[model samples]
Target chain A: MALLSLSAVTLTFAGNTVLNEVSFNVAERSVTSLIGPNGAGKTSLFNSITGFYKPQQGSIRFDGTELLKLKPHQVTKAGIARTFQNVRLFREMTVLENVMSGAHCRTSAGAFAAILRTPAQRREEEEIRARARQHLEFVGVWAEQGRIATTLAYGHQRRVEIARALATEPKLLLLDEPAAGLNPTEKHDLVQLIRRIRDEMGIAVLLIEHDMGLVMQISENISVLDHGEIIAEGTPKQIQSDHTVIEAYLGRDDGEAFLDE
Target chain B: MALTDIVLQQLVNGLVLGSFYALVALGYTMVFGVVKLLNFAHGEVYMVGGFAGFIVLSLVSGTLGSGWSGVAVSMVLAMIGVGFLGVLIQKIAYQPMLSAPRLSILITALAVSLVLQNAVLGLTGGRYVPFGADLGFGGVNLGNLFISYNQFILVGTAGVLMLSLELFISRTQYGRAMRAVSIDKDMCRLMGIDVNRVIAVTFFLGSGLAAAAGTMAGAYYGSLWYFMGFLIGLKAFTAAVIGGIGSIPGAMLGGLILGLLESFGTQIPGIGSAWKDVFSFSILILVLVFKPTGLLGRSEQERM
Candidate 1:
C-alpha cells in the first residue's frame, strides 16, 4: 500500500511554474527515488510534502491522513520527516543535542516541568537521551556525538542529520540529496545505511538525488522528472532503458552512446 | 568606614544590583534571539511584575501574615502574572508584525512601553506607591555595610533562577527545543516541533524571570513608581548587548560586570555616583568597538 501519495500537485513561484501537476507514491517500506537534472523541481516537491510550501491544487494523503490540513510540525506529527540538501543541523549545538532535539514531537514536557524537574519529566528525559544516543549509534555517529555539528566532516554531518531525522520516528523519511557531498567511500556507506534503514526499521524511504549510480543501486523504483514534470518511472532496468529518461538527462538523441559500457 | 569594608560593601551591592539587571537582560536576550525584536516594552513587563508583586504582597500579607514568606509568595504570583502578560503581548502585538518590517515592530515595542507606562500612571494617579518592610524583609547591618533581607532574596533568588535556567536549557527536552529553535526555526518545524508554542513559551520563561526580578527590585528599592522600569529596562538591555545579545550566561555575566562597574565607578572622585548610567554605556561602547560579539556571544549573526 502507498504510504505517501501526491495527487496532481501543482506549485508555482513568482508566476513561473515550478511543479505542474506532479504525482507519485511510495509503498510501505519501499525505497523510491525522484531523480532529475537541475531545475527539475525535485526539492520543491519535498518542500510541498514537508508543508514548507503549499501547493495551489492537489491532495497529499499519507496513510489515509490528509497532509494539506496539517502544518509543518504537523507534517512530522503525521509521520513525515526530512533532511535538507545542504545540511541544516543546528550548527552550534553538539551532535547529540541536535539529534535529541528531533525527539521533541514524541515527548510532551512543558517549561515548568523542565524547570521543576518533576519525576515524570526526569524519566522522560532519560528516555529521550537513551533514544537519541541509539539513533546516533545507528548512524555511526556515536563517537562524534560530543562534537559540534558544523565542525564535523561533510560526510559525518550528513549521517548526523539522518540520525536526527530518524529520532522523529517517522513512518516515511524524505532524504533530499543525502549523498550530495560525499566521497565515493562515504557514498558506499550511505547506500548500505539507507538499505538497512528500510530493512530494519521498516519505514518507507523517498529520496531526491542527482547521483544516478547511488539511486540506481539502492532504489527499488525510480521516477525521472524534468521541466517540472515526471517524465517516466519504473524499475532501474526499465528507467535506464527508457528513451524519455535518457532524453531528459541527455538531449534529443537519448545519449545511449555515453552509457554503452 | 575602613577601606576593606567599603570595598566589600560595594562588592556586595554590585552583585545585588547586577542580579536584577541580569534577570531583566535575560528576557531581552531571549526574546531578541527568537523573534529578533528588541521588545522595547520589556521594561514595562518588569514594571507590571513589580506592581503585581506589590499588590500581591500587600493583600497576602494583610490577610495571611508578613515577612520572608510573604515576599516569596508575592514574587511567585508576580512571576506568573507577568509571564502571561508577556505571552499576550507576543500573540497580539509582536506575532502579527513578525513578518512586517523589523523597524515597524521596534516602533510597536516603543508604543507598548509608552502605553503600559501611561496606563499604570493613570491607574495609580501618577503617584509613587511605598512598599513597607516586614520582619526580616528590612535590611540588616554588616559592620559598615548595609544589606537587606530583600537583598538576600534579590541576589539569592536571582542566583537560584539563573542556575536553574542554565540547567534547564542544557538538560531538558523542552530546553533543547528552545536552543534548536533559536538556531533554526524552520528546521525545528521539520522536526515536528511547533515554532509558535516554542516562542510563546520562551516569552513565558523570559518574562517570568523579568517579573521575579522586578518584584525583587521594588522591594529592595522600597518604592514603586509608574516609570521605574523605564531606566532599568534600558540599562538591562545595555547589559544584554554587552554580554552578547542572544547568549544566556553572557546576559548574567554582563549584568554582574555592569553592576560592578557602576558601583565602583561611583567611588571614583572625578566620577560621581550619578555617573553610573554613563559608566554602563561606556562599557557597552568599549565592548562594541573591541569585542563586537560581547563576552560569551559566539556569533556576529545575532541582530544588533
Candidate 2:
C-alpha cells in the first residue's frame, strides 16, 4: 500500500492556482522524485503535502489516515517530515542540538518533567541524545556535532539538515532540492545516503530536484510538472523522452534551479 | 561614613536592586526573543505579582502566623498566579496581533498595561498596601557596613532562578524546542513542535520570574501599589537591552550592571541619589556608543 497518497490536490493563492488537481502516491519503501520547471508548482505540492498549505480540494492520506485534518505539527506526527529548499537549521545552535530538536515529536518529556528532571525524563533525554548521535553518524556528520550549524560548509549544512529530518524517523521523508548547492562529491554522497535511507532503513522517500542528473540516477519513479499540472509520470526513460516534459524545459537545458529569493 | 564603607554599602544595595532588575528583565528579554514583542504590559505583570503576593500573605498570615515561611509561601503562590496571568495576557493581547504590524502590537500591549493597572487601582481604591516592616529576619553587620538577611534572600533567589533558567534552556527538551522556535516558528512546526505551546510556556516562565521578583521586592521595600511595576518595568527593559535583549545571560548581567551603576553613581559627588536613573541611563548610552548591539546581542562576531 502507498504510505502517502495525494489525489486531486488543488491549492491557490490570491486567485492563482499553484497546484491544480495534482495527484501522486509514494509506495512504501520506494523512491519518488518530483521534477518541474521554475514555475511548475513543485514546491507548492510539497507545501500542501506537509500541511503548510491546505488544499481547497481533495484528499491526502498517510497510511490510510486522512492527513488533511491534521495541523502541521500533527502531520509530522502522522509520519511525514520535510526540509526546506534553503537549509533552515538553527544558526546559533550546535549541529547536535539542531538534530535533537527533530526528536521532539517522539519524545515525551514535557516542561514539568524537564524542569524537575525526573528519572524517566532523564532516561528519555539520554535516549534522544543517543538517537540523534546515531542519525548524525548515519549521515556522516558525527564529527561536526559540536560545531555551530551555520558555520559548517554548504555541503555539511545540507547533511546536517538531512540528519535533523531523519531524527524525526518519518515513514516518508521529503527533500526539497537536497542537491541544490552541493558540489559533485557532496551530491554523490547524498545520492548514496538517500539510497541507504530507503534500502537499509526502509523509509519511503520523495524529493524535489532541479538536477536532472541526480533525479534520473536516483529515482525509481519520476513525476514531472508544468504550469501547476503533472505533465508526465513514469520511469526515467519514459520521462526523458516525453515530448511535453522536454518542451517544458526546452529553453533551460542546463537543468539547474535557481531560487527567486 | 568613610568613602570605602559607603562604596561597599552601595555595592550591597546595588546587588539587591540588581536582583529585582535581573529577574524582571529576564521576562522582557525572553518574550522579545521568541515573538519579537516588547510586551509593555509586563510592568503591570510585576505590579500584579506584588499585589497578589500581598493579598496572599495578608490572608495566610492571619491563619498561619507571619513567619518567614508564610512570606515564602506567598512568593511561590504569587509567582504561579502571575505566570498564568502572563499567559492569559499573551493569549488575549499579543496572540491576535501576530500578523499585525509591530506598532499595532506595541499599542495593544500598552493598552493591556493600562487595563491591568487600572483594574488593580479600581480594586484597591488607589492606596498603598504594606507587606509589613519586618520579614521577621535580622541582618549581618561589619563595623559601619551592614547587609540584611532579606538582601541575602533577594540575591540568592535571583541567583538560583537565573541559574535554573540557564539550565532549563540548555538541558531540557522544551528548552531546545523553545530555541528552535526562536529561530524559526514555521520550522518548529515542521519538527512537530506546537509553537503555540512553546510560546505559552515562555510567557509562563517569564511572567513567573517577574512575579517572583515583585513579591521579593514588596517584601524588601515594604509596600505595594497599583503603579509599582511602572518604573521598574522600564528599568528592567533597559537592563534587557544593556545585556542584549534576546540573550538570557545578558539580561542577568545587564540587570546586575545597571544596578551596580545606579548604586555607585548615587554616591558620586555630583550625581547623588536623585540622579540615579540619569546616571544609569547615561551608562547605557555610553555602552551603546561603543557596543551597538547591546552586550550579548546576536550580531556580535567576537563574543569577548
Candidate 3:
C-alpha cells in the first residue's frame, strides 16, 4: 500500500517553476531512493511533503491525510520525520538534550505543569529521556550522549541527527544526503545503519543521496529524476540496464551502444 | 575610612543594587538568549514599567486599602500592565522586523526606546515623580549596622525570582520549547512549537520582570524619572555581556559582581565617588578581554 503519496505536485518560486506535475508513492516499510542531479527538486519535494512550502498545485497524502494542509510540526505528528542534507543538530545542546527536543511533540505537559514539575510530567519526561537514549543507542551515539553535539565528529553528528528524528517515532523517515560529507568508512557504516533501522524499526525510508554505490546497494526501488521530473523508475536491475537512465546519467549515450553492453 | 566598615557597607549596598540589576538583567539576557537580538528598547521597557507602577500607586492610594495592601495591589496591577505593554511592543515593533536584518531590528528597537521615553516625558512634563513611601516597615539594626526591611525584601525577592526563572527554564515544557527554539528554530518548528508564539512569550516574561524591578525601584527610592531605565538598562546589558550572553545564571552572577565593584569603588580612597561608572566599565572590558564567556559559561565546540 502507498503510505505516502504526492499527486501532481507543482512548485514555483519567484516565477520560476522548480517542480511540475510530479507524482509518486512510498510503499509501507520499504526503502525507496530518489536519485537526481542538482536542481532536480528533490529537496523541494521533501520540503513540500514536510509542509515547509505549500505546493502551488496537487496534493500530498500521508496515511490517507492531506500532508500539505498540516504545519511542519503537524507533519511530524502525522508520522513523517526528516533530517536535513546539511547536519542541523543543535550545537550548543548536549546529545541527550537534542534528541529530547524531538520528543517534545509527544510530551503533553504544558507550561504550568512543567514549571511545577508535577508527578505525571516528571514520569513522562523520564520516559521520553529513556526513549531518547534508546534512539541514540540505536544510532550508536548513546555513549556520547553527555557531550555537546557540536563536539562530536562529522559521522557522529549525522548519527545524532538521525537519532533526533527517530526520537519523534515517525512511520516514515526522510533522509536528505545523509552520507554527503562522510568518508568511505563512514559511508559504509551509514549503509549498514540504514538497513538496520529499516529492518528493526519497520519504518518506510525515502532517501536522496549522491553516492550511486550506496543507493544501488540498499534501495529496494529507485526513481531517477532530471530537470524537475521523474525520467525513470524501476527495480535495481531494471534501472541498471534502462537505456534512458544510462543516457541521463552518462549524457546522451547512443541508445544502441548502451543496449549492447 | 575603616577597611572593615567600608567593606561591609559596600557589600550591603552591593547586594541591594545587585538585586535590582539582576532583575533588569534577566530581561536583557532572556531576550538575547532566545532571539539573539540585543533589544535596545528594553531600557525603555523598564521605564514604562516604572510609569505603570506610578499610575497604579496613584490609583490604588485613592481607592484601595490604606497602606501595604494598596501598594501590593498596585505592584500586581503594574506587572500585568507592563506585560501588556511588552506584548504591544512585540506586536507593533519587533514582530514586523523578524525577517529583516539584525541591524534593522536593532535600529527599530532604538527607535521604540526613544518613542517610549519621549512619550513618558510628554505625559509627565519631564519631571521626576515621587511615589510616597507608606508600605515598608522601618529599618532594623544588626550589630552596629542598620538595614531597611525594604532592602532585605528587595534582595530576597530578586533572589527568589532568579531561582524560579532557572527552575522554569530547566524544568518546564514552555522553557524546553524556548530552549529548543533557541537551539534550532527550524527543528523547533518541526516539533510543533510556533516560533512566533515562543518569541512573544519570551518578550512578555522578560518585560514583566523588568516591570517588577522598576516598581521595586520606585517604591524603594520614592522617586522616578523618564530617563531612569536608560542607565539601569545599560548597566544590566553590561552585566549580561560580562556573564555569557545566553547563560541565565551567568547574568545574575555578573549583576551581583558588578554591583559590588561599583559600590566598593565609591568607597575607595582618592578614587572619589564620581568614577563609579569608570570603575564598572573597566571591569567589564577586562572580563570581555580575559574571559569572554563570563563566569558560568562553558565553551561550545564547533561543528563542521
Candidate 4:
C-alpha cells in the first residue's frame, strides 16, 4: 500500500490553474522522484502536499489521515516533512537550535512548563537536544551546530536543513531540488545522505530534481510532471525512454540523444 | 545639594523609570520580532492592564491589607487578564489581517488602540482614577540618595520580570519556536510548529510584560488615566527601535538608555524638567538618523 496518495489534486491561483488533476502515489520506503522542466508546478505540488497551498480539489491521504483537511503544521505532525527548494533555516538560531525546533512536534512542553522548568519538561528538552544532535551528526554537520545556521557554507546549510527535517522524524521526507546549487562532491554526499535517511532511518523519500543523473541513480521510480500534469510514471529507465517526457524536456523529437547522455 | 548627590538621586530615579520602559519595551520587541508588525494597541493593552490591576487591588485590598502582597497579587492577575486580552486582540483583529497589506494592519492597530482608549474613557467617565495604594511611602536612605520603597518595588519587580522573560526566550521549547517563527514562519510550520499558537503565545508574553509594567506604573505614579498608554507606548516603541525592534536584549538596553537620557537631559542647566520629553524625542531622532538599527539591532544585510 502507498504511504502517501494524492488523487486528482487541483490548485488554482487567481483563476489561473497551477496544478491540474495531479495524481500519484509514493510507496512505503520507496525513493521516488518527480522531474520536470522549470515552471512545471513541482514545488507547487510539494506545497500542496505539505498543506502550505490548499488544493481546491483532491484527496491527500498519508497513513489513512486526510492531509487536505490539515494545516501545514498538522501535516508535519502527520509524518510528512519537507525541505524547501531554497534553504530556509532560521537565521537567528544556532544550528543545534534549528534542528531542535524540528522536534517541537513530538515534544509536548508548553510555556508554563518551560517557565517553571518542570522535571518532565527538562527531560523532554534533553531528549530533544540529543535527538537534534544525533541528526546533525548523521548529516555530518555536528561540528558546526554551535554556529549560526545561515553563517555556514551553502552546502553545510543545506545539510543542516535536512537534519532539521529529519529531527521531525517524518515517515516520509520530501526534498525539493536538494542538489540545486551544490558542487559535485556535495551532490554526491547528499545522495549518500538521502540513501542513509531512507535505508537506516526507515523513512521514504519523495524528491523533486532537475539533476537527471541524481534522479536516475537514486530514484526507484520516477514521475514526470509538465504544465502541472503528470505525463508519465514508471522506473527511471522507462521515464528516460518515454517519448512524452523526452518531448516535454527537449521540446523536440530528437531528445532521445539528450536522455541517453 | 551637591552636584554629585543630585546626579546620584537622578540616576536612581532614572533606573526606576527605565525598568518600567524596559518591561513594556520587551512587549514591542517580541511582538515585532515574531510578526513584524508594530502593534500600536500594545500601549492600550498596558493601559488596560493598569486598570485591571487597579480593579484587582480594589477588590482584594480590604481582605489582603493593601500591602506588597496585595500589589503582587493584583499584578499577577492583571498580567493574566491582559495577556488573554492581547491574544484575543491578535486573533480577532490581527490574525485575519495577517495576509493584508502592512498599512492596513497598522491602521487596524491604531483602530484597536482608539477602541481601547474610548472604552476605558466611557467606563471611567474620562476621569483620572487615583491608584489609592501608596507603595512608596517608606524608603532606605544611603548617603545623599534616598530610594523609595515604590522605586525598589518597581525596579525589583521589573528586574525579575525581565530576567524571567530572558530565560523563557532562551531556554524554552515554545521560546525557541517563537524565535524560529520570527525568522521564517513557513519553515517553522514545516518543523511541525503551530505558527499561530507561537504568535498567540508571543502576544501573551508581550502583553503580560506590558501589563506588569502598567501595574507598576500605576502604583508608582498614583494615578491612571485613559490616555496614559499613549506617550509611554510611543516611548517604549522608541526604546524598541533604539535597541533593535526585533531584539529582546536590545529593547531592554534601549529602554534603560532612553530613561537615563531623559533623567540626565532634564538636569541640563537651562532645559529644566519641562523639556524632558524634548530630550527623549531628540534622542529618538538622533538614533533614527545615526543608528537606524538601534544599539543592538543587526543590520538587514547581516540578518539576511
Candidate 5:
C-alpha cells in the first residue's frame, strides 16, 4: 500500500480551481518528485495532502487512515511532515529551539509534566533534544545550533528548515522547493541529504521542485503537472524522454528557451 | 503634606502602583510574546479578576478566617476564576480572529473590554466599594518609614510570581514551545504543536497573572470600579512597550522603572505631580526614537 495516497484530489480557492482531479501515490522509502510550472498548483496539492488547504473534493489517505478529517497537527501526529515553498523558521529562536519544536507533537510529556519537570518528562526531553541534535548533525547544521536561525547563511538556513522538519520523525517527508535558492555545491549536499534521509531513516520523500536537474538526479519517479492536472508520470528516464512531457516543457516559447538552455 | 512627605508618599505610592502595573504587564508581555498582539481586553480580564475576588471573598468571609488565610483563598480563587475567563475569551473572542487582521482582533479585544466593563458597571451601579482592609498584614515600622503590610504583600507577591515565571520560561518544554511559537507561529504548527493551544495557554497564564494584580489592587487600596482597568491597563501596556514588547524580564524591569519615574517625576519643583503620565510617555517616545528595542530587547533582522 502507498504510504501517502491522494485520490482524485481537487482544490478550488475562491472559485478558482487550482488542483483538478490530481492523484498520486508516494511509496514508502521512495523519492517521488512533483514537477510543474509556476502556476501549475504544485504547492496547492502539497497543501491539500498536508491538511493546510482542505480540498473542495477528494480523499487523502495516509497509511490507510482518512486524512481530511484530521487537523494539521493531527496529520503531523499521523507521521506526515512537510516544508514550505517559502522557508518558515522561528527566526528569533536559536537553531536548536527551532528544530526541537518539531519534536513537540511526538513528545510524551504532558504540559503539567513538562512544566513541573518530572523524571519522565526530563527523560523524554533529553531524548527529544538528542534526537533534535542528531537531526541537526544529519543536515550539517549542528555546529550552528547556537546561532539564531535568521542569522545563518541562506544554504545553512535551508538545512535548518529541513532539520526542523526531520525532527518531527515523519514516515513521509514533503519537500517544497527545498533546493530553490541553493548554489550548485549546496544543491549537491541537499541531494545527498535527501537520499540519506530516505535510505537511513526509511522515510518516503515527496518533493516539489522547479529545479529539473536536482529532481532528475534524486527522484525515483517523476510526475509532471500543468494547469492543475497530471500531464505526465513515469520513471525519471521515461519522464526525460516522453513526447508530451517534452511538449509541456518546450512547446511554449519560454519552454523552448528553457530547452535551448 | 510637606514637600518631603508628599515626595516620599508618592514615591511609596508609585512603587506600590508600579507593582500592580508590573503584574498586569507580565500578562500583556506573555500574550504579545506569543500572539504579537496586545490582548486589549486584558484590562477587563483584570477587572473580572477583581470581581471574582470580591464574590469569592463575600462567600468565604464567615467560612474562612478573616486573616491571611482568607486573603490567600480569595487570591487563589480569583486567579483560577479569571484564568477561566481568560480561556473563555480566547475561545470566544480571539480564536476566530487568529487568521484575521491584527486590527480586527484588537478591535474584538476592545469590544470585550467594553462589554465586561459595562456589565460590571450595570451590576455594581458604577460605584467604588471598599474591600477588607484586614487583608493588610501588620506593617514594619522604621523611624519615619511607615511600610504597610498590604504594600509588602503586593510587592512580594509580584516578585515571587515574576521569579517563578522566569524559571518556568527558561527551564520547561512548554516554555520552550511558547518561546518558539512567539517567534514563529507557522514553524510551531509544523513542529506538531497545536498553535491554538499554545495561544490559549499563553492567555491563561497571562490573564491569571493579571487577576493576581487585580485582587492585590482591590485589597491593597480598598476600592475598585468598572473603569478601574482603563488607566491601570494603559500604564501596564506602557510598561510592556517600555520594556521590549515580548520580553518577560524586560516587562518587570520596565514596570519598576516606570514606578520610580512616576514616584520621582512629580518631585521636580516646576514639573509638578500631574505630569507623571506625560513624563512616562515621554520616556516611551525617547526609547522608541533612540533604541527602539526598549531596554533589554535585541534588534531583529527581517526574514525574507
Candidate 6:
C-alpha cells in the first residue's frame, strides 16, 4: 500500500505553473526516486509534499492524513523528514547537538520544563541524547559527534544531515540529491546506508538524484518529471527503456542516437 | 576620597548598572539571533515592565506590605506580564512583517516603539511615577566605598537570572531548537520544531529578563518615566553589539564592559557625568570601526 500519495498536485507561483497535475505514490518501505533534468520541477514536487509550498490545487495524503492542510512543521510531526540538496547542519552547534535537535518533534518538553530541568525533562533529555547518538552511529559519524557540525568534511557533513533527519524518526525520509557531492566510495556507502534505512529501520525513502547509475541501482520505482509534469513512472528496467524519458533527458534528435547504443 | 577609593566605588556602581544593561541586552541579542530583527520596541517592553511592576506593587503593597517580599512579588508578576506582552508584540506586529523586506520590519519596530511610548505617556500624563517601594537606603561600608543594599539585591538577582538563562539555552531541548532555528529556520521546521513558537519563547524570555531589570531599576532608582526606556535601550543595544550581538555570553560581558566604561569615563575631570553617554557611544563607534563582530561574535561565515 502507498504510504504517501499525491493526486493531481498543481503549484503555481505568480501565475507561472511550477508543477502541474503531478501525481505519484510512494509505497511503504519502498525506495522511490524522482529523476528529472534541471528545472523540471523535481524539487518543487518535494516542496509540495513537505508543505513548504502550498499547491493551489490537489491533495497530498500521507499515512491517511491530508498533508496540504498541515503546516511544514506539522507535516514533519506527521512523520515526514527531508534533507536539503546542500548540507544544512546547524553551524554553531556540536555534531551531537545537531542530531539531538531532530528529536524535537518526538519529544514533548516545553520551555518551562527545560528551564526548570524537571525530573521528567531530564529523563527525556537523556533519551534524546541516546537516540541522537544512535542515529549518528547509524550514519557512521559517531566518533566526530563532539566537533562543530560545519567544521566537518563535506561527506561527513552529509552524513550528519542524514543522521539529523533520522533523529526526527520519520516514517518516510526524503533525501534531495544525497549523492550529489560524494566520492565513488562515499556513494557506495550511501547506497548501503539507504538500504539499511529501509531494511532495518523500515523507513520509506523518496529521493531526487541526477546520478542515473545510483538511482537505477537503488530505486525500486522511478518517476520522471519534465516541465512540471510526470512523463513516466516504472521500475528501473521499464524506465531505462522508456522512449519519452530518453527524449526528456536527451533532445528528440540526440535521443535517437543514444537509443542506438 | 582617595583615587583608589574613588575607583573602587565606581567599580561597584558599574557592576550594579551593568547588571541592568546585561538583562535588557539579552532581549536584543536573543531576538536578533533567532529572527535577525532589531526589535527596536524592546526598550518599550522594558518600560512597560516597569509600569507593570509599579502597578503590581501598588496593588499588593496594601496586602503584602512594601518590603523585600513585596518587591519580589511585583518583579515576578511584572516579568510574566511583560514577557506575554513581548510575545503579543511579536505576533501582532513583527511576525507578519517577518517575510517583508528587512527595512519594512525595522520601520514597524520603530512604529511599535513610538506607539508604546505614546501609550505610556498618555496613561501617566508624561509625569514621573514614583516607584514608592522602599527597598531600604542602608549600605555596607568597606573603607571609603559605600555599597547600598539595593545594589547587592540588583546584582545578585541579575546574576542569578543571567546564569539560569545561560543554562536554559545550553542544556534544554527547546534551547537547542532555538539555536538551530537561528542557524536555519526552514531546516528546523523539517526537524518538526515549530519555528514560530521558538521565536515567541525567545521574545518571552528576552522580554522577561528586561522586565526583571526594569522592576529592579525602578525600585533602586525610585523613579519611572515614559521616556526611560529610550536612552537605556540604546545603551543596552550598544552592549549587545559590543558582546557580539547574537552571542549570549557576549551580551553579559558587553553589558558589564559598557557599564564600567561609562562609570569610569565620568570620573575624568573634563568628561564629567554629562559626558558618560558620550564615552559609551564613542566606544560603540570604535567597536564598529574595528571589530564589527563585537568581542565575542564570530564572523558571518562561522555564524551561518
lDDT of 5 by residue, A106-204 (tens): 887776676456899888878888998999999888999999898999889888888888888899999999998889999999999999999999999
List DockQ for all candidates: 0.89, 0.86, 0.52, 0.85, 0.57, 0.87
lDDT of 1 by residue, B134-229 (tens): 645467887888886666767888999999999988999888898888888999999999999989989998899988987887777787899999
- RMSD of candidate 6 to the truth, in angstroms, is 2.0
What local lDDT does model 1 show for residue A5? 92
Minimal lDDT window, size 10, model 6 chain B? B295-304
Candidate 3, B266: how far from true, in Å? Answer: 1.1
Error of 1 at A134 (Å): 1.0
Q: Is candidate 4 or candidate 6 better by DockQ?
A: 6
Query: Total clashing residue pairs per candidate?
Result: 0, 0, 0, 0, 0, 0
Using DockQ as the measure, name the better of candidate 1 and candidate 6.
1
Report lDDT (CA) for all predictions: 0.89, 0.88, 0.83, 0.91, 0.83, 0.93
Which parts of model 1 have CA positions greater than 4 angstroms off?
A: A252-261, B133-143, B301-304
The residue-by-residue lDDT of candidate 5 on B63-172, one tens digit each, is 88546677778988898778878989889988888889889999998899999999999999999976663664578765566778777777888888888778768766
How far off is residue B137 in model 2, in Å?
5.0
lDDT for model 6, on a 0 to 1 scale? 0.93
Q: Write the per-residue lDDT of candidate 4 for residues A190-230, one digit (tens) a residue.
A: 99999999999999999998778899999999998889999
Best by lDDT: 6
TM-score of each: 0.97, 0.96, 0.89, 0.97, 0.91, 0.97
Deviation in angstroms for B39 in model 1? 1.4
- Model 1 docking category: high
Residue-level error in angstroms, candidate 5, position B155: 1.9
CA error at residue A114 for candidate 6, angstroms: 1.9
- For every candidate, C-alpha RMSD to the true structure in Å: 2.1, 3.0, 3.6, 1.9, 2.9, 2.0
